[model samples]
Target: MEFRHLGRSGLLVSEISYGNWITHGSQVEEDAALACVRAALDVGITTFDTADVYAGTKAEAVLGRALKGERRAGLEIFTKVYWPTGPGRNDRGLSRKHILESIDGSLSRLGTDYVDLYQAHRFDHSTPLEETMVAFADVVRAGKAHYIGVSEWTADQLREGHALATELRIPFVSSQPQYSMLWRVIEDEVVPTSEELGISQIVWSPIAQGVLTGKYLPGQPPPDGSRATDENGGRFMQRLMSDEVLSRVQQLKPLAEQAGLTMAQLAVAWVLQNTNVASAIVGATRPEQVLDNAKASGVKLDADLLKAIDEILEPVAERDPARTYETSPKERP
Candidate 1:
């Protein structure tokens, strides 16, 4: 797989990194999860992204077991905080107590002493930004994590956070956001601001949660066992399952053929086209799916095709810049 520097940092991550969000420890059984992880490593993927809130934190344990024998120095493992991992009040948010304590639990679950990157899963509205950043600084200083990043944070929030990281001498090197052909909310503002601050995006849902793969037909019931059919995961995907969006996505199949890529590869490559995107995080249920996605690594799409894609999907896509902040919880969940 092709590798690119994650933001302005010297660290390089796979162009298409393996992420276990809905699959590991929930949708897929442990054996299937292990097979997918092996498929990723077989295709040269060295970066893995998970979260403490994913599958109630069981995703990390499964991932740890999957990568048990690999050399730790050769992999870049990432996990996040700020979501409720337990029933207690201290079990969530970016407060000093939570951040400090959460990192230890994450490390233990991930079977590693330190994570390559530790991210705030979301902006903590109740906690002071200084408290959060200072906690992150402590995480880096104590060698619990090598870098700090945040997910789904607004442009203004990124600017403020970056400033705090600079003041604290922490490496705030990456932004994790939901980005895809169907989601352009980050392009108008976050991309420019992150560029100025030297932060690159490690985008999730590059395929628009599989909508871009053309598997969901317009006005039709979602296929059996699809993400849209899963009660828990389906909710997040309902917004994009509309007939208008599905019809528009279906229009891209010919473009994929024109580019000699499968619909999924086309979708994955489309995100990496952006210079500010360091990696596109992909999750899968089977080894074949992982293999197909890894092929998108170095494929380059011409400007004409990209323009055609925009013309087809932009009208149906979510581009309102404020939608970024709107997606973040009004208060911590």
Candidate 2:
């Protein structure tokens, strides 16, 4: 697997990393989860991403169980905070109280003394950004977290946070965002800003929550055991399986065929095309899925093939002109 520098930090992560978003605790059993982790390691994936809110905090526990004993030292584990772990109001956000308490809980659950990287799951509009940054800095100083990051943060927020980290003498190494073939919003603002700020962009949902994998076709019934079949799968996504998106996916099938790769592999390769992207965090339920996603690391898309993909996706871009427009036009222009 190809390794890239995670922003300006000395750290380097594999091009394709493994994550437990909706699969570790909610969907797959322990044995299956262990097998998937093993597959990722076998393919040279050193980073594993998890979040405290995923599966109501059970995902971390499952990951801890999987990485128990000698195997834990061989991996770089990353997890996030800022989501409610319980019904209580104190259980969520990046408040100093929550941030202070949450990292300890995550440490205990993950069966590790420290995480390689700790991220804020989202911008905490309620708390002062300084408060949150100081709390994260404390963790780093205390040896509970090695590096700090934020997820789904706006350009302004990221800039402010970076300034705060510098003032506090804390190093913020990365940012995680939902980026995929179907969602290119980050390219307009987040990508460029991250590149400028020397923050690594470790993207999640690189497959558009499985939309680009060609699993849900237009007019077809939802596949058995798919994420769409879950109770939390809202009506919006259920209705999103439109003829247009599926047709676009169908058009791209031959491109994958010519490359001697699966559509899923092509989808992943497409996400990693951006040089600014440090890593793409892929979620997998089975060992084979891990193996399949890892294959994308080996399949390089040339400039011509990337142009072809852009052409194929142009129709979808036209449909959502607002999203296609950059929110930060000043940065773009």
Candidate 3:
């Protein structure tokens, strides 16, 4: 597997990392999840990304147990905070209490004393940025986490947080955003800001929620057991499941053939072409899927193929950075 440094930090992660967002606890059985993890390891994937809010906080436990016997020093395990993990008033957000309390719970669930990286799942508009950064600093000082990151954050929010992270002298090294051939929201602002601040993007949904896989054929029912058909796991994918999007995706199969890549590999490789992207996070329910995605690591697409992809997908691609997230005052746990 090819590896790259996480931002300007001294840590290197596999270019194609494994992520269990909707698969570990909600979409697959424990044995299946464990099998996928093993497949990732067998194929040389050393990075795994999960979030505290994924599968109602059960994904972390499954991933923790799956990697129970692996050498911890050889893996880069990452998880995020700032989401409601419990029904309490102080169980969420980037507040000092929440970050402090949440880290202990995460560590306990993951069976690890520290995570390689702990990210803020979202910008907590309700919490003071100072309180949040100080809490992160404490976590690093206490050896609970090695570095900090943010997910789906606007460029402005990232700049604000980076300023505080620098002031506190914390290692803010990564940004996790949903980036793909069809999702260019991060390219305009987030990428530029991250380039300026020494942060690398660990992008999720590099296949645009499987649309780029060319499995959801146009004018047909989504394949059974596909992400677009799963009730709980498919909610966020509805936006990309439109007929227009599916039709556009179908047109990419010939390009994949010409490039000697599967549609999924093309999609993942497309994201990695950006120098600022440290890794592309791929989720899988089957072991073979992991194997397919891992091959995208070192595959380089020529300039003509890339231009063809843009021409075919640009009309339907979502590029408005503002659509990435909506931030405002709200109660966060």
Candidate 4:
């Protein structure tokens, strides 16, 4: 697999990292999840990303069990905070109490003392920025985390957090956002700001919630058991599941054939083409899906093919810079 540095840090992560967001403990059984993890390892993917809120905290435990035998030094495991993991008032947000306690819970559940990178899943409007950054710095000083990152943050938020991290002398190395051919919200602002500040993007949903896979056909009830039918992830796919979007996505089949890539591979490869993207996170319910996505890690698309992809998908793509602001929770959950 091809590897790239995470932002400006010396740490290198696989270009195609494995992540378990919707399919780990909730959608797939333990055995299936374990097999997918094994498939990722067999194909040379060494990075895994998860969030504390995913599947009610079961995702982290499942991933922890799946990686039990591997040498810890060889893998880069990442997790995030800033979501409601319990019913208590203080169980959520980036407050110092939460981050400090949350890190320990994550470490114990993951069967590791420290995560390679710990991220804020979303910006906590309720918490003071300085308070949050200081908590993160403490986590690093305590050896509970090696680096810090934020997800779905706007350019201004990134700039604000980056400055505080610099002041604290901590490694704020990565940004996690949803990026794909169909979702271009991060392009106009976040990309430029992150590039300027030396923060690389570890993008999720590179296939636009499976819309770019070309499986959800236009004018047809989605094929059985597809993401459209999934209760857990279906709500997030609503923005991309329109007939117009599906029709446009269908037009890319020929381009996929011409480029000699599966639609999914083409989608994943498209995100890696952006120089500021350090990695693209892929999640799978089956082992073969992992094998197929790993191949996209090192594939390079030519300029003409890229232009063709843009032409076909541009009409349906969401490029508004304001969309990034809409992604974050307005209030801490």
Two-way lDDT contest, 3 vs 4, winner: 4
RMSD of each: 0.7, 4.1, 1.2, 0.7
Stretches of candidate 3 off by over 4 Å are 327-333
Q: Please give, for residues 32-119, the per-residue lDDT of candidate 1 as tens digits.
A: 9999999999999999999999999999999999999999999999999999999998899989999999999999999999999999
Question: lDDT of each model, Cα atoms only?
Answer: 0.95, 0.83, 0.93, 0.94
Which regions of candidate 1 fall more than 4 Å away from where they truly are? none
**Residue pairs in steric clash, candidate 2?**
none
Model 4, TM vs. native: 0.99
lDDT of 1: 0.95
- Which one wins on lDDT? 1
**Tens-digit per-residue lDDT, 1-333, candidate 2:** 988888898888889999998788878798899999889888899999999988989999999888887466567889999878977788888889888899999999999999989998887767888999999999999999989998877767789999999999988979887777777777777777888889988998787667778888877877998877776543325434678877887788888888788888888888788888889999888899989999888567888888888899777632232342332222201
Candidates sorted by lDDT, best first: 1, 4, 3, 2
Q: For each candidate, what TM-score against the reference?
A: 0.99, 0.93, 0.98, 0.99
What does the lDDT read for residue 279 in candidate 1?
Answer: 96
Clashing pairs in 4: none
Judge candidate 2 against the unseen true structure and give its global Cα lDDT, from 0 to 1. Answer: 0.83
